[model samples]
Target: MNTNTTIKDIQIISLPRIEDRRGNLSVIEKEVLPYEMKRVYYLYDVPGGAERGGHSHIDQQEFLIALSGSFEVVLNDGEQETTVSLNIPNKGLLIPKGIWRELKNFSSGAVCLVIASDVYLEEDYIRDFDHFIKSKNS
Candidate 1:
């Protein structure tokens, strides 16, 4: 796995939205994303001021979107950190492997949609901050 990644590597993608008189529609194709999506999941009904996602992946990548409402994503690359806000349905954040992420500051009734590059695996996750730093140094 490549450990020489930084928070700058993260990408914000703007999806195409088709507006009409009835309703608006947004489309996401496989080619538009940075990786081929293998898993799809969503986070909803989070209590106010709650947080989620506090780990880094070894071989998985993810794309996160705010389906409704808004929230913040805090990203850390063992050295530097930054926060990104997701409020628009047509905008998505692409998070590559080796970066630790934390989701926080969710508004009421917010829905977070996530698309992953790989299936879930326990061994691929770095749950400890010390371990993540060590991995990046090594």
Candidate 2:
């Protein structure tokens, strides 16, 4: 796995939106993302001032989008950290492997959509912050 990745590698991708008189349309293709999406999931009904996603993946990449309300994604690479707000439907955040991420400051009725590069695997997750930092140095 590539453990050399940093917070600098994370990016906010803008999807193509077609506006119309009735409604708007947004599109996402496999070629536009850095990795092919294999799993898709979403988080909803989160209470206000709650948090989620306090772990790092070993070999999986992810893209996070706010489908409804707004939230904040805090990313840390064991050295530096940054926070990004997700409130737009056409915007998504790309998170590479080997970085620690925490989702917080969710508004009421916030819906967070996530796209993963790989399927669910418990072994691929670094749930502990100390272990994640140790793995980054090793």
Candidate 3:
């Protein structure tokens, strides 16, 4: 884990929006993200007041967008914490490594789209908060 990482490293990235008579379209090309995207996934059907994501990544970085409805992401960087809301399709939250994140307050029909820098690797995740803090401080 990166010990120097903080909440300020998180960024709000805006995708290019092309408007047309029919509807607006957003694009995510190679230059959009800091790293090359290797995997993509989405989360949906979360019951009201239910929460997701209680872990911090050791190496993987992720970009999360609210494709539908809305949700709040609570981020902690061992010394400080903040909450960000995602309710737009063309905007995304870019989360770097070594920060703990929790997704909550999901409205009905909310869909969270995640674009990741790496594939699913269980060894890359630090799931416990105490262990996460220890790793960050060490």
Candidate 4:
């Protein structure tokens, strides 16, 4: 494995909150966070006891937020790992590059929002766990 450390800001993101009598809204924009606009994705209706995102990106930084419900994200920076649980909509986890991450232990009916620092490049993503390890080492 690479054994290289991924940049992690210990500070949680504080999103802009707008409230009204009917409902409230929180916005996540590229300027709001530290990264520039690249790509955005979301995962929803994740089955119980199921998992997703068992992979890593070589040069991608992302922010993960739970829009609804909750889930656990296991991030391994080639050595020690950190477990980040997502339940709040206004806060997000800054996921640095060159780290292996797996989104597992998903609660029912969860929505995950990811704002990335790069465009959707399949070649940039290490989709397989074994390949990710090998590429990290190389």
What is candidate 3's lDDT per residue for 47-84, written digit by digit as tens?
Answer: 98789999999999999999999999999999999999
Question: How large an RMSD does model 3 have?
Answer: 0.7
The lDDT for every candidate, in the order shown, is: 0.94, 0.93, 0.96, 0.80
Comparing 2 with 4 on lDDT, the higher-scoring candidate is 2
TM-score of each: 0.97, 0.97, 0.98, 0.84
Please list the residue runs of candidate 4 whose C-alpha ends up more than 4 Å from where it truly belongs after superposition.
Answer: 1-3, 7-11, 134-138
lDDT of each residue in 54-103, candidate 1, tens digit only: 99999899999999999999999999999999999999999999999999
Model number with the top lDDT:
3
> Given candidate 1, what's the lDDT at residue 114?
97
| lDDT of candidate model 4 versus the reference | 0.80
lDDT of 2 by residue, 1-138 (tens): 338898889999999999999989999899878898999999999887778999999999999999999999999998999999999999999999998999999998899999999999999999999999888888
Write the number of the candidate with greater TM-score, choosing between 2 and 4: 2
RMSD (CA, angstroms), candidate 2? 1.0
**Backbone clashes in model 1:** 0
Task: Look at candidate 2 and tell me the lDDT of residue 115.
Answer: 95
Clashes of 3: 0
By lDDT, the candidates rank as: 3, 1, 2, 4
For candidate 4, the per-residue lDDT at 77 reads: 61
Model 2 per-residue lDDT at 4: 88
Between candidates 1 and 3, the TM-score winner: 3
